[model samples]
Target: MKKILLTVFAITFFINAKAQSAEVAITKKENDTGKIYTSVEKAPQFPGGIQSFYHYLAATIVYPVDARTKNRQGRVIITMTIEKDGSLTDIKVVRGVSPSIDQEAVRAMSACPKWIPATQNGLPVRVLYTVPIAFTLGK
Candidate 1:
């Protein structure tokens, strides 16, 4: 009974911690030209959809030769602002594995076509978006 209670307490604590962190992130403010939102009524979408966006990434990302040779593999987290006009700006790597790999991920994202801008209260608004690109080596 004690073990079960301990497990339940741990789970509840973890969940509350996670929720708090997410709330903080969603409430973060940006000092850009216009107000940038982290949460929106309708999120921005790729031309076709999420699947098409993945297809675009797969076709555009070129694994850096140096990183591949050095056996560096990990996920790069990128953050960008999707503008009200459906353009992307302020592309940055929030988490990176290596310089070359990170740059490659940025390059691919930079070359992407415009996305459908996010909406809030029935009007288009700029929103902060994050994506993770993974680099892995095949056996």
Candidate 2:
């Protein structure tokens, strides 16, 4: 049927678009640095450390009203690259529960303070970090 064909086309288009975007990001990072690393010898960290990072998230995020009304609760896994300058870039939701929730996660990440840049061989390096933002309704 026409509807089925359209659906298939849409899915294919979306997949291709995502792949292209990812490729572009990878290419840009490689050009900026020699390589992108998932983990470095000294991984990036919030100024105050892990505990403070969690506290910052808890303080910063404002739950989306639509998601709260729908009772949608889950973790949104976000992937971002920490640049050698300690700033975050290329933030994207790797696993998203809902649009509103996902947007909120990205917003929080964008507002994050600079981290202590990751290091390899005692030199700063760009690192890819994945974090999960949990959305739970307060009963």
Where does model 2 exceed 4 Å of error?
Answer: 1-29
Provide TM-scores for the models: 0.78, 0.78
List clash counts for every candidate, in order: 0, 0
| lDDT by residue for model 2 (53-131), tens | 7667777778889997999987788889888899999999999999999999999999999999877778887777887
- Cα-based lDDT at residue 22, candidate 2: 23
Against the reference, the lDDT scores of all candidates come to 0.72, 0.72
lDDT per residue for candidate 1 within 78-110, as digits (tens), equals: 889889899999999998999999999899888
